[model samples]
Target: MAKRELTPEEKARNGRNIALALGLIAFVVIVFITTIVRLGGNVVQRTF
Candidate 1:
């Protein structure tokens, strides 16, 4: 099957969608790392 060329508007929309997806993924990863770091110190309890 032959692929058709994307118009300027379609190309722009596709680029915006890709950027949004990547930005969302990055935000999630940052939040996850922050949570892990913040909670990591208290995870292990010391016995007296």
Candidate 2:
């Protein structure tokens, strides 16, 4: 049996998809860290 091959256009599209996925993951991590910091700030409020 022979395996199917990917053309140059298909390869480029796959690479672009992977890059977009990584960018989205990075964005989510940044948002998560910012949310944690904001939440912690509220929890550690000072009483003056």
Candidate 3:
């Protein structure tokens, strides 16, 4: 089967989707790092 090319709208949508995904991933990573830093090395010794 022959491959088809993407329309301009499809390209734009793909770009936007990629940007949103990257932004979300970055946000999650930042939050995770912040949580780890806030917890620190003593996290293991702390009682729940």
Assess every candidate by TM-score. Answer: 0.84, 0.74, 0.87
* Candidate 2, superposed: residue stretches over 4 Å from native: 44-48
Model 3: ten consecutive residues of lowest lDDT: 39-48
As a whole number from 0 to 100, the lDDT of residue 3 in candidate 3 is: 81
RMSD of each: 2.8, 3.7, 1.3
Candidate 1 lDDT by residue in tens digits, 1-48: 899999999999999999999999999999999998998867676455
Which ten residues in a row are the worst by lDDT in model 1? 39-48
lDDT of each: 0.93, 0.92, 0.96
Residue 20 miss distance in model 1 (angstroms): 0.4
lDDT (tens digit, per residue) of candidate 3 on 1-48: 998999999999999999999999999999999999999987998888
Q: In model 2, what lDDT does residue 33 have?
A: 95
TM-score of candidate 1 versus the correct structure, residues matched by position: 0.84
Worst 10-residue lDDT window, candidate 2: 39-48
List the candidate numbers ranked by TM-score, top first: 3, 1, 2
Ranking 1 against 3 by lDDT, winner: 3
